[model samples]
Target: MRILVAPDKFAGTLSAVEAADAIAEGWSRTDPEADVVTVPMADGGPGFIEVLHASLGGELLAVTVRGPLGDPVPAAVLKVGETAYIESAQACGLVFLPTEADGRTPRPGVAAQASTYGVGELIAAAIDAGARRVVIGLGGSGTNDAGAGMLAALGASSEPVKAMTSGPEGLAHVASVDVEPARERLAGVELVAASDVDNPLLGLRGATNVFGEQKGFVGDDAKLAADAALTTFAEAAGRKVADAKGAGAAGGLGYGILLVGGRREPGFATVAAAVGLPDLVATSDVVVTGEGKLDWQSMNGKVPVGVAGLAGSALRPCIAMAGAVQVGNRELRANGIEAAYSLVDIVGTEESFAHPARSLAAVAERVAKTWSRR
Candidate 1:
């Protein structure tokens, strides 16, 4: 039996590379002689740079950039040839958001105050390193400032620089925006916004309403204010991409990318091409893909679904192994997955969280018992 294992990061636990290794280990335990090929995947999220670096063997340029709360954070850019791959989560990820003084997780107020200034810094660093094309992975952000902080960092002028880059509270006070300097800074450079999300920059299905609750914009009042603040910022900038497919990605970081003439591409597609996923799927006997959770969002250009689609197109059986499987069997079938296995279902929630790699391996072993023809 030949099996191909490809998975995204399991959220806070296993990275895509680790998850693929665990799955390969367990499958081999079930069928020691089976041929196993492992490929880590990402959809422009936390593991974007790591996965690309692993597959492409790029020059990893390390740098320190401002975090969401103005603190310094370690980050890296992957420069392959003339193209640079940057993961935005390193600078403003939800995991980096600071907790309250009471030791509780950040609330809407704190999320509202987060910034994306570091992303601009990373882009600048990539440019300085002689990258003619920069591909920015936009997801897992902690800020809700509509990329105002990033714009400010990239040389966009506003009435009060501090307020313009200080998150929503300061955004509410902003008046005008000049993006000429920022545009000039990127002259002769190509920018690509790599993301899975397609939400607009504002309104019901937009960033603030669709993804705000997870980042702390919970109440109606808070969402309204956030939307209004971003609206004011957008009007000031005079850029017309609020309704663009990925304009709401990474808390409006997509909008900022568009404002600077960046084109949007599906993050999964970008990674898939880099990793030669299509060729691998066509030649593999069985395909296995996974992530932290298999939910409605998994259908939205995420790694697992994208892999499954390729497997299906190649007439190969595709299976999914996830930390938790929330989608129904019908949905799984609709998405081209032959079956879905969950670590939580096999080992329970406690063990799954405590030993993610082990639990995932165990699940893969059991799955192999059913699928391994060897």
Candidate 2:
């Protein structure tokens, strides 16, 4: 049987490639003769660069850029012809921050102070190197600045550019934006924002309300930050940023890109087309795809759901193996997932994740055995 192994990153543990390898290793033990194909997946987030690099032949360029809290960090971009692939997570991802720092832990904050300036710097660098097209992967950002930082780096000033770029409050202090510098530098470049979520810039269902808690906002802080940034962005751009779908993504980096001539596209569709997932599914007997967590949100434009949709079209059975499964079996079945299994359910959350490799191997072995019996 031809079994395709595809999985997203296990968030805080294994990358999509590593997870697929672990699954393949375990499956080999259960069915040595089985044909297994591995395809790592990403939803425009942490693993975006690696995925794009693998899908499109490109050279990885590493550079030093500003981090989420203004610290110097190593970042990379994929150079593919006149188009470059930029993953925002590398510069301002939550993983860049230490879980425990000093006496008080640092939290991902909402506001314009936490800008996407470093991301802009990366894009600027690409532009300087003669890139005519730029595809920015918007996922796993830790800030909520309305892309003020990005505009600042591109020489678009909405107030005096602050020396210390740190949090939302810091961004709120800006007064005006000037894009003449970047406009001259990137006059003819095409910018595309590849986004996974579909949230807008402002409102109860916007960026702060839907994703702020995940970034550490509590009580009214998220709402206040979102409102302040939205107001500033509207004043500067002369266009209402509120209610724009997918504008709340990547800590408002989505809106930031739009202000600077970037268009938004569904991340799953982009990646799938690049990776030739539909073509692969046509010949595969079984397709396996999963992520760190599976919930109601998984059905709403996530990678797995996209994979399932494609698999259904090709008349192939699709199964999911996740780090944690929060949705019921009925829901998964309704979504075209023939079976859904969680590593935590079988071995307990704490124990399973204690050694991610071993846990993934165990789950894959069980899946292989079950499939062999059928």
Cα RMSD of all models vs. native, in order, equals 1.6, 2.6
CA error at residue 176 for candidate 2, angstroms: 2.5
lDDT of each: 0.90, 0.77
lDDT, candidate 1, at 215: 84
lDDT of 1 at 180: 88
lDDT tens digits by residue: candidate 1, 16-76 = 9999999999999999999999999999989999899888897999999999989999999
On TM-score, the candidate that comes out on top is 1
Q: What is the lDDT of residue 191 in candidate 1?
A: 97
Sum up the clashes in candidate 2: 12
Give candidate 2 regions above 4 Å deviation.
97-112, 163-167
Model 2: what TM-score? 0.91
How many residue pairs clash (N, CA or C atoms closer than 3 angstroms) in each of the candidate models, in the order given?
0, 12
